[model samples]
Every structure is written in C-alpha cells, then in structure tokens.
Target: MKKTILSILIGLLVVCFAGIVSADGIETGIYYEVDVSFDDDVEPGDSFDVEVEVTNIYNQNGTYVDIEDINVEVVIKDIDDSGSDDLDDDDDIDDLEYNVDDSIDFEFEIPLAVDDQSYDIYVTVEGDDENNGTRYTETFNFTVNVEKKRHKLMMKEPVVNYETLKCSRTTEVSVTLWNIGTSDEDVEMTVYNTELDISEKSSFDLDAGDDEDDIKTRRSFVLDLADAAAKTYTFYVKAEYDDGDERETEPFTLKVEDCPTEEPEEEEVTIVEEPTTPVITTPAVVEEETFMDQYGAALLLGLAYLVVIIVGVVLVIRLKKR
Candidate 1:
C-alpha cells in the first residue's frame, strides 16, 4: 500500500513539471527588421545597391532560442498600380545566412530593365529557431516601393549674335542640344527661317543626364540679311532624338533695325571784316504855267487878218475899174 502511494505522488509531480516546461518554451519574438537605403528615386536601365538587416528580441522566460541555416533572398514583383492583384514575380536574389540577434547586412546590386515599373521589392528571410531544445522554422517578410522611370528630352535657349539685328549685316544664330533621358540618344538639330532665307541642319550624339563638364556640339545658322527688311523676324528651332522623341523651343525673335550713320568731322573757324554802306541821292520837282504865251500868239494872229482884209478890198476895186 505505501509503494502505491509513492507511485501516485511521483506521477502528480511529473505532470506539474511538464505543464511548467510547456509554458516556458514559447517562440522568441523578432526585435526589428529594416533595409538600408540610399536612393528612393530609381531610373530604368540603372544598377544600384540594396541592403537588409534583421534582429531578434531577447527571450525573458525559461529556454533561450537561437536561429541557424538562415536563407535570405530578395524578390521583385510587378504589382498592379492599384496594388490589389497578386504580384507577378519578376526577379530573385541568391541565398544568404544569419543567426539569432545577429545584425545581418546584405549588399547587392539590382539591375532594372527599361520596361520595369509598378513593382515591389520583397526581402524574405527563413531560419530554424531552437525551442526547448527543439528546432522550429520561421519566416519574415519586408517590402519597399520602386517608382517608375522617366524618359524626357529638353531644349536650351538659343544663342544669337544680336537680339536687335542690322539689315545690312550677317547674323550668326547657334543652338545647343542636350539629352536628359536615361540613355544615349541620336539628336538632329535644325534652325530655319524662310523669310530670312536661313536654313541650317546639323546632327550629333548626346550622353544621358546632366554634367557640368560635358562637351556639347553647338549648331550655327548664318542668316544673310542682304534682302531682309527692317522688322521682327522669327526663327524656328527643332530637336529630334531617339525613338521619335522631339521637342521644339518657343519662337526665337530677332529685331532688324536700320544701320547707323557716321558722324561728320569738325572744321577750323576763321574771322572776316564787314563791308561799308553805300551813299544815296534824290531828284528835283517841276511846276506847270502857260497863259502868257497863249495871249501873245493870239494878238499876232489878229494883226495878220486885218492886213489880208485891206489887200482883199484893193484887189476888189481894181477889178471893178477894169
């Protein structure tokens, strides 16, 4: 009877200890998961580096758990723009390893294609954790956003010899072309003005992105103003790049003015003497009277008439006597 009682006490004690062990053997929780990032803006056909780090929280209860056989991978999937559909797998990274509480940093290069967009980067880490001397598997997932690449072309302001030109002189107008896309481009630049009889075409190759020290080809169009009028003239500039990418600047204007005249030279001054005044003379005035001269001529005429009457009487008597 005493042996049976001792066996029962031993069984009860074993059951109590088993319950305690089960309570103390829970899985260790993850402390933190993060990715090292340098650039948030990514362009197409670009290769860049990405990093990842994971840490485990310290267990406070009974048994300590350590992880092994850690395999880390990076997967880029093309998720829809609305982010509702299942992601289509596009790329995968190779396997890696890590331990519990170990700071795992993974650095690798990822090359993006020209058509890759609306995607997500998923970093998955799998490892075996020790739970009360028993190993269990665990997985962790992390995500990041990859933006779409931009393909663009731009035009710079044109250079000209004169904003206000002269109609009798030649003017040189030059235009510089730049490539702002993600790859090299074949560019064709043209400057034309039919009114001025100016048409010049030139072609060149440009590199991707902006550089302060980059060499650029400047195309020049010579405008002969021999027959041009004095007015505002508009010149058109066109730039054509890769895959039918074309851009044109606003109408550049040049004002033609009349040519300036030369100034006359100054001459020496000399002093001269003034001329003398000339003398003047006046004529005398006359009076009108003739009554005396008329009376004298009348008396003589009366005397001659008396003599002729006497001669006439004598001649008459002589004739009677005959």
Candidate 2:
C-alpha cells in the first residue's frame, strides 16, 4: 500500500514540473531558452563571433526532446558595396538567410561581404523530442553596429600636354581620374580659375570608365601671359559628389600655356621719274589784198558818164528824124 502511494506522488510531481518547464523554456544563468548573443562589436570584413545556449528540462522518459534545424543568421540592410548611405531610419534589419550546426553550443563567424552599417542578429531553433511529443521552439533577436569608409580620387596623370605629355606650345590634354577607394561612388566635377571651388557651374558626372569627362567643360576666364609671363597658367577642376553620404575630390589640375607671338613685318616702297622741258615748233602762213581798194571809185564815175552821153545822142537823132 505504501509503495503504491509513493508512485502516485512521484507522478503528480512530474506533471507539475512539466507544466513549469513548458511555460518558460529551458534556462541556464542569463540564457533563458534558445537565445543567440554576439561578442561586443563587429566591423565590415570582420567575422561575427556569436554564442547560443539552449535549455532542455524534462524527465528521462523513453521519449525525449531533440533540438533540430538550429539556424543562426546575421543580416543587415541592402547595399551595392559602392557609394551607398541608404539605411533604415527606424533600424529595420531583417534576416534573409541563416546558418546551423545542430548543436546546443553553436558559434557563427561569417566573413561580412557588405557595406558598413548596423545589422540585426537572429537565432531560430527547431525542437522535436520523444516523451513530451513536440515542444515549442524559441527565437531570439538583437542588433550590431558597423561602418564603411568613402572613396577618394587621386590624379596620377599630371596637367601636362597629354598628347606630347609636356609643355612646348599651346595644346589641349586628356587627364585620367583614378578610383583609389576600395568601395565605389559617383563623382561630379567642376572647373575654376587655378583654385578649385564647388558651384552650379557646368560640371558633368564621371564614372570609373571615363573619369576624364567629369570636368570636360570649363567657364571662360582670361589667362594673360603679360608681356612675357610664364608660358602657361594652370587651372583646376574641383570634383564633388556623394562619397559615402559625404563629398570630396581634390586638386584636379589643367595647364594653360601662352602661344608663340611673331613681330609685325616691314612695308616696301617704289618710285618713277617725270620728263623735263617743253618742245615748241614754227607754223607756215599765206597773205591776201582787199578787192574794194583795187577799182571801186573810178569804175562808178565812167559808168555814169557813158549812160548820159548815150541818152543825149538818142534825143537829138529823134528830133531831126521827126
């Protein structure tokens, strides 16, 4: 009779503890059920060292609980690995994938191949056992902070005559802008008088392929060689754009040399001589006498006398005859 009573009491105790264990998964020190925690801080390119501890509280009946499919995933936001500052304003980091080792004490350190930003850590557990049938698995989450550096442009090709690559006469040159940053970013470029400054001024976008085109167009400014000033004055193109949410690009240079000038040529002259002295010659002539002076007075007197004499003779003859 005593043995039967003892057996019943043991069964009752088992049932009570089972309820408590189910209510609050397994527990060990600060680790409650299935929870994953990282070790301090993590940076880009650095590995993630995390620890996970699980609790399994139950009587050793023929049926037992077994933890399966334990996935530990470390995730952050989206990144193209170039120049990017797109982050969740509210810290929205989701676990897109996971890693598992099927062990109670699990550790994960994945080589981070992404941009610099904070990430949220996630622990997922799939638990299945014999005695208590199947139990509810646990999931824990946390976040970590990270940061990436921006890109820098270095001008290796000097502002010398790109074709000849030297300063001889007035000439144009082609320059190259190098992407010295490990990461990628877009570069906007502008030009100013020798000294560089950022303004709306007419600059264009430059990609990795042709960084040269960044400062292709420049504003007009007089560069006087002054009598015999140095052949050329060097100007600069200041490239500015989003580099990891910031702006940069330093000392983009351009050289301006004076063209060779020639002195004015002398004017020529020609002359012709004029003739001297006037040449005059003699002209021949004929003379004549006046007609009236020759016979006018005598001829008129004789003509009057003759006419009177003839009239008188006629008158005498006619009287006699009658």
Candidate 3:
C-alpha cells in the first residue's frame, strides 16, 4: 500500500508540472491592442461617452486560437493639471463576461464638472483570457484628451419699436444678447415670422463680462409687412454662436391694422323727358283691350255727334213748313 501511494503522488506532481509549462508557453503567444476615443468638443457640466476597443490575439502550436470565455473590467482616473499617481477616488467598472475571438468593445460615460480648461483621462483595462480553465490576466493603459469648453450664449426678451403695422409697410425688431460664459462669442441672430417676411441679424461679436450692461449686445431686424393680413404676428428669434451654442427667446408679437378707406366722389345729375311715349300695340280688338277704350273711344263719339246734328236739321225744316 505504501508503494502504491508513492507512485500516485509522483503521477500527480508530473501532471502539475506539465500544466505549469503549458501556461508559460501560452503567455508569450498572447497579444492585445487597446484603442481609446472620446468626444473632443465636450463642454463642462455635460456628459459624454467614451469607447474602448480591446482586441486579443492568441496562437498556440503554430495555429490561431480563440478564448472560450473572458471577463473585462475598467478603471478611470481623472488627472488634474498636477499629475498624481494615487487612484483612491477613481471610477471602477464591474467585471463583464464575453466570448472573445479577435476583438471586443467596451463603452463608458464620463461626466465633467469643472472649470473651462483642458484635462486628461487615464483608463486601465483588466481582463482575463480563459482557455480550458487556464486563466491569463491582461492589462492595458491608455489616455484620452478633453479640450476646453466654451461658454453659453444667453438671449433676452425681444423688443419691437412699433406696436402696430399696416399692410405694405416695414418695421424693425430689436433683440439683445449676452455672453454669459468665460470666453468671447461670435453670435448670429435669426428672426422669422410665421406670416411676415423679416431679415436676420448676422455676425455680431460679444465679449464676456460680469456686468450685464457691458456684455449685452443688441441687434435690429427689418420686418416687412407687405401683403400681410390684419392680425397678430409672432416673430421667433434664435441666437447661434460660433461654437455651436444656441439660445432662443420667447415669441414677440405685433399687431397689423387695416388702413382707413376714403369716401367716393358724387357727380351732378340732369333729368330730361322723353320725346314720345312708348306704345305697346297688339292684335286684340279695342273694346277688349281696356275699360276706357270700350266706353270713351274717339271714333264712336264722332258717329253719335253726326247723327244728332242731322235729326236737329230735319226737325227745324218740318216746323217752318207747318
């Protein structure tokens, strides 16, 4: 029994030694690449995403190999102007598992809340490659650059010189803008109406300052009300800066009234009688035409008068002979 136990112990030691040799050989064949990228135009007090692509390559016995399973973790360090090595307050990402062949991607979000200045982010990626339960830990370090942030552009309520406008007329709309940040801003103002035509104010430079009066810059937009109707018109104003900063103001409204109408002129009139009345002749008999034609016609009266005159003359002659 003692001899058998000794032989089993020797066999176990040999198997352990073989695994150690295989791990050593595979470590030399393992290779990886780290690529880091983030937004370069990120502003202060804003959040942005950073992407890291980790690619692992392995070859054993002169043939390409694939890692059956792996786990990845990341640590972020925000380096100030003065470099420091301590990472007590740094951000740490938990472990994630994946089956990797050639490459894998990891994404993280970074929120910046500091002054408008340049900064650097250091990232450390820790991962393990497991092939048949043999684990190899791989680590890579990379740096990302963050540029200076620009200030915000602010706009006040717009003003209109005229309270009301008439059709086929033009007016001006005034607006003031301020650079409320740390740097100067090149601003352009655009003014538009839903029912009227207006021109924009462009290319105005403004400097930042603590006092509101010093930093304020005003511009005027010409609004033409030609062919506009009689109603209220709202003008929307938007201010854009050189660094893609934008601000919009509340709608400014103006009234349009119809012009007064003029009275028409009156001309002299003349009345003249017609030379002859218009007669309507028909084929019906005169007696059936009207009541006056049946009783008071001129032709019938002339015959009755002739008969009376002849009777009177005969009676006078007969009286003279008797």
Whose lDDT is greatest here?
A: 3
lDDT of 1 by residue, 1-322 (tens): 9999999987665432221111111222242233334344554333444454544442437434565555555444443222333332222222222333333344333322222333445544455554433332233233343444244445668888877866456778878654445566677777888876787777777665334223245678876766677888888888776655655564688888888788998896888879978777676666565776658788888889999999999999999999
Model 3 lDDT, residue 90, Cα:
22
Model 3: lDDT equals 0.55
lDDT of 3 by residue, 113-161 (tens): 2234344443333344344555544444433443443567667788888
Give RMSD to native, each candidate: 25.5, 23.9, 18.5
What residue pairs are clashing in model 1?
Answer: none
- Reference-based lDDT, each prediction: 0.53, 0.41, 0.55
The order by descending lDDT is: 3, 1, 2
Q: For model 2, how does the per-residue alpha-carbon lDDT over 50-169 read when each residue is reduced to its tens digit?
A: 555445432345433443333333233332233232222112122111121222333333222343444554444434443343543434444555443445445433353332213343
Question: Model 2 RMSD to the real structure?
Answer: 23.9
User: What is residue 32's positional error in candidate 1, in angstroms?
Assistant: 19
TM-score of each: 0.36, 0.27, 0.35
Residue 247 in model 1: lDDT: 59
